[model samples]
Target: MSTYHIPVMLKECLEGLDIKPNGIYVDVTFGGGGHTRAILEKLDGGMLYAFDQDADAKANAEEFQQHRSFTFVESNFRFLKRQLRFHGVKQVDGILADLGVSSHQLDEGSRGFSTRFDGELDMRMDQGAAVTAKHVVNEYEQKDLIHILSAYGEVKNAKTLAAAIIRARGMKTIHRNEQLREIALTCAPRGREMKYLAQLFQAIRIEVNDEMGALHEFLEQTPEVLAPGGRLVVMSYHSLEDRPVKNFINAGNIRGKQEKDFYGNIIRPLESITRKPIIAGEEELERNNRARSAKLRVAERVQSK
Candidate 1:
């Protein structure tokens, strides 16, 4: 587990939860069980429920099987409310979500999540997913590719890159990361090849995994699954994810638009605890490069009048 993936902002995330020794908590992205282990340590007889879609993560959860207080659900956090219901859990004290791909997935060449790895064009976080990165690269229309690269990746030259992909695939299918990278290099600006490729891959992976959609679903259910005053701690790695999370915490919805009651009181479901997202400290940055992009936000469920 030590090498699976280093937990980003470990101390900060644990602090954000403001853990209760005997309260029920959930770790939605139980990547390598690093944070799960820490949460378990804090609990005496409390419960720590973990969720992970990847089979590899499920196997890692087995390491904590000896602790009866720990429960692992082999499913996506998008199904948060329902899965918890299966375990007779109606509400929780806190929920911690570490968004984006885990370091283990990136380091494993076969997963095709890293720019350094020249592997198959398969970026599904759950291997069972049907739509692989190869499908998006080879089958998506030019306009669709442009939209994905522009919106999901924030790639500046999305138009040119999308056109290049379409043209290159006409000669042969883009079935490998190296093959796609070669085509992307043709459009990448000087000295920025890696950055462009990273964005490109991010865009494709998000689309294949329906990350934005899943995040929206998960956020919508938090109000129902968390008890009043329960904490919602999320760590996101990109602006695309951070924006929605920030919006939800601020406006009580992803659109960032406020709703009011007949009495003119704002009908917010959660209260923001961190005005600004937390970042990794210098000491942690030195130990793990993955922490460099992490941004953590904490909020607590609002009590109903």
Candidate 2:
């Protein structure tokens, strides 16, 4: 599993969870099950439930099927609450979500996640998803492309890039990663072609997976799914993901603005445990490059009065 993905900030994530020996836990993005395995080791009578929409992840989880303490759900974390209910789990002691593309997905060229590859533009994290990167690139209107690029990728010249894509697709359908990369290069800044291309791909991938929407749904359910005092540990790769997470933790909602009650008391579902998001230390960064972009935030469910 280490080769598949050397779970970023493993030590920090564990410490953030502050695992209890008998606490029920959920690893929302199971990936290679590295964090899930670590959680299992700390539990004596506790149970660990893992969720992943990717079929490959479900296959990876087969390794733990014999362990009565572990259960894997073949679904996205967006359905966190409903899935838990199906399993007879009303609440959990802790939940951990690593909101980054898995190493396996990026390294596998056919998955169409990396600019370094020239595979089909099919970046659906869940292959079963209706939309794919190809659809976003070829079928989306120019204005929609601009929005996705600007909002999801933070591209500086999204409008120009969108025009380029529109023109390119008109000549011939953009079906491959290299094909889209070529179109993006025309609008890329002179010296930062690689960065520009990466941003373009990131935008399409986010749209294909509806990453932000799913994140919001999963977060909305966290306050209800977590037992009082239970931890919510999330590691996000980009600002698109981290910003909402930060807001939800600090303000108890994605809007990042406090909602007050009739008595002027703030209504919040969780309290931020870390004053700021935790980044990988020099040691972890040296061991795993993926750790460089990781931002981990910890929160505890606020008890109702």
Candidate 3:
């Protein structure tokens, strides 16, 4: 992999939190420790807890000193609140989650998070996770397949693609990218193979990891865990992930309904740190095209009256 992690909007994220020397912080995605390392530099006696589900991430822990203030948790960040509680900490100053697959996962063909590579269709963020791209292709029913393709991938011919997978599974297994691609080709829009295939793979990867589900849980707990005036810096790479973030931030709840008070005024739990989600600057885009889709939403906790 050329870059282990190309931290998107590093400067912007750092500024979003306005990190304090004594404040506690958490980096939910510790891919290559880029954000964790950056957070570490800004802390004096502050505690930094880094979490990554991939066991390989533990190997990268050697890059930083085993400091008193820094600790690593080899688990999913979806349990951000529970894990923090284990450390006997509450109400952190800030929390950062760079959601979805890491650059290293995509860059390495074996992990198969990207359509660019022809590796096995195994896209489990945590290797221990039971489901994989193979399971989605071979096991899911037509309707469920369509749901995943449309919900996570936004694939145009979702029903057709789901039908194809269903028919193909009747004959034999579709395990690797090559086999899945061959089956998907029949349903994919002709001359639009790459994008369509990418969508399908993305959909499978999201299901395999439960990325959106986990994000929802974390966001639900955000208001409770963050200190008053605490910051949440989240970077989402696509609409599937960004949409919920958009909805949850704009309104108090993910359902997008206004929370009415006695006066019928909408009571919101969060105030947008940025009126609009921040995007990568041109220079950053030149270095990493992945930054093109990255949408950052920062919010501060609002105390309930």
Candidate 4:
């Protein structure tokens, strides 16, 4: 279970937090504990709570071996509100969520998270969870498949791909990565194999985890969980994740627009720290390919009751 998770945009996230030595903070996506370690170093009297839905992330959780103020909770972050309340805490000074699967999950052959890997069709981030890519491919209807592929995967040929899947799935249940790849290839244009297949896989993974839906819910609770002047630093790998976060912080809604009162007074709980999303640099892109798509957005909670 020795997995490699290279935290993307580490420095930017740390700066975004504006870490207070004695302020309570949370790392919602504790993949490999890379960022968690950085967060710990910046804290003294403050405590850091890290959450990861995947049990496998615990394998790298050992980095904080001697940490007294770090707590790792294994669960989906969509329920972040309830979970933190259960801990007898209400507000936190800072919260960071890296809303993407880790490199370890993608590199591991058995995880089926990568299109490069030929394994089972299962892509459940939390192995203990019931839903997987298999269910999405095997049970999803043509209309549903089209929606997932187009919206989540951003597949250009979503309708064609969905049709191909439906046709192939009828003959037999697709249980392995190789079979799924073949289906994708057969449906895709001859030269578009790589691009088409990757998009299809991305679509299925998002659907299996309800990544977009969960991200929306998580952002909805952020304003409530954050204390006044608390920082909300979020790192998103895809537009779907970043868009909502960017909108919510700037306008206090998911639409990324400001709200105005009858008297034209602007009211919002959070203020967008970055007018545009922060992208990884050339150095980081070269070091970690994952950084190519990473976008870091930060916001500070405004004074509100």
Candidate 5:
């Protein structure tokens, strides 16, 4: 099959997983199956389960239907534990999650994920999802928009931009991506217009899909889903996504707060395999600019206490 997305840091992610040929594995974000196909190549009697909610991803998985060792789950990774249990899988040997928008999603303008494209304001990772960018931009209260911009995007002038959105939508409902872009352009800083626009779109996308909320739920289930000595390899494109993954591996929670037992031992389900996130090599950067922001973190499930 043709390439859909060039998997970022492919070698590093494979090394991080420390794949066992006979082990059970999962690729939670099987966008174009770049990583999934690689993992499948290394498997013998092992089974690999891939998860994605996007309709396009489901279609991409069709080729693997005949592969005895592969299974494609048509659901979000947030339901990780429940889905695994339903499939009669108590635990898996390794889990790989690449939390980034797929190349196809952005390239398809009707998906409304790119700033350069003009399409309807619909940015749901899962098309079936109720909320969309249109709902967020037009229906959210001014204060809520300000909070989403500041917290999710880290946009500096969140209040001003939120006010602008409120005013623009007040005149007419913002139905298209271009309409919202123009409103944000008016509030964007002179030299950083593109960056500001990207941040603004990122904030709305995150809210529309409940990305952070799904991430927290998924992370909480990793420990229970992983077998002892199993690896959890994750690649995140932004700090917002990386922080929780780092904290959960180190502290057993998304908050990064360590809890102590009666004997003063810090309790956590996974042990950090990498103290710092691994970045893509210079060669990979020259080949694919999207790999520039990618950060890979690895952790292992600790033996039962």
Candidate 6:
């Protein structure tokens, strides 16, 4: 499990959940089962439902299947509410989502999740998914590409990058990571080639997986699925992912809009547990560089007054 991917801020995530010995819980992003394994340990009579869309992640979860309390849901976390209902689990004590691509995904060149590796342009988290990064790079319109690059990846030269991709693909389909990388390099800034490439790749990957859309859908369902006072512990890797998590926790909506009651009391489903997000300690950071960009926020489900 450790080799598959180290669970970033493992201790912090556990603490944030405030685990109860016999309470039901869910691990929404069961990549590598690192977090799921830890959560299972804390359960005595409690049930733990682990969800993942990746085929590799399901294989990693096989080790825990024999355990009486563990149930692996082979689906995207975006279908959280419906899946829980199917399992007769209307509400849960806690839901922990470790967002973004796993270390295993990035290290495997064939997955095309890493800019460092030259491989197929496929970046589908669900291997069976219809869309791939190759499709997005070769088929998406220039304006659409620009929007994803700018909004999802925060790429500084989105317009130039999109135009370059459009021009290159017009001559031939962009079918591999290297092909797209070369086109992106043409538009990259002088000294920030690596960063620019990463942003470009991130944008494509996000669109291929519909990451932002899935995230918004998943966040909207959390309040409905979590039992009152239940914890919503999420660790996001980038601002694009982190912003919505932060907003949902603080304002009860993804837009960060706070609806109030007639008396002016905030009408929200969750309350932020900490004033700021929790960061990994130096010890953890040195051991795991992935934790460097991670921002963890914990919020408890609350009923409106």
Q: Tens digit of lDDT per residue, candidate 6, span 151-270? A: 988998889889998899999988888888888888888999998988888888889988989999999999999998899999999999999999898888999988999999887899
Of 3 and 4, the candidate ahead on lDDT is 4
Of 3 and 5, the candidate ranking higher by TM-score = 5
lDDT of 2 by residue, 1-305 (tens): 66887898888899999999999999999999999999999999999999999978988999999998999999999999999999999999999999989888888888889798789989987988899898999899999999999999999999999998899899999889888888888889999998898788888898988899999999999999999999999999999999999999988889899999999988899989999899999988888898999999999998766
Clashes of each: 0, 0, 0, 1, 0, 0
lDDT of 5 by residue, 1-305 (tens): 35578899999999999999999999999999999999999999999999999999999999999999999999899999998898999999999999999877777779899888899999998999899999999899999999999999999999999999999988999999899889999999999999998899899999999999999999999999999999999999999999999999899999999999999989998999999999999999999898999999999999886
How many clashes would you count in candidate 2? 0
- For model 4 the local lDDT of residue 300 reads 93
- In order, candidate lDDTs are 0.92, 0.92, 0.84, 0.86, 0.94, 0.91
TM, every model: 0.98, 0.98, 0.95, 0.95, 0.98, 0.98
Among the numbered candidates, top lDDT falls to 5
- lDDT tens digits, residue span 48-102, model 1: 9999989899889988988988999999999999999999999999999999688
Question: Candidate 3 lDDT, tens digit per residue, 128-170?
Answer: 9888888878888888988989988998888988888888879
Off by over 4 Å in 1: none
In candidate 6, stretches whose alpha carbon ends up further than 4 angstroms from where it belongs are 303-305
Clashing pairs in 4: 247-256
Better of 2 and 4 by lDDT: 2
Per-residue error (Å), model 5, residue 128: 1.1
Clashing pairs in 2: none
lDDT ranking of the models: 5, 1, 2, 6, 4, 3
Of 2 and 4, the candidate ahead on TM-score is: 2
Model 2 stretches astray by more than 4 angstroms = none
Show where candidate 3 strays beyond 4 Å: 303-305
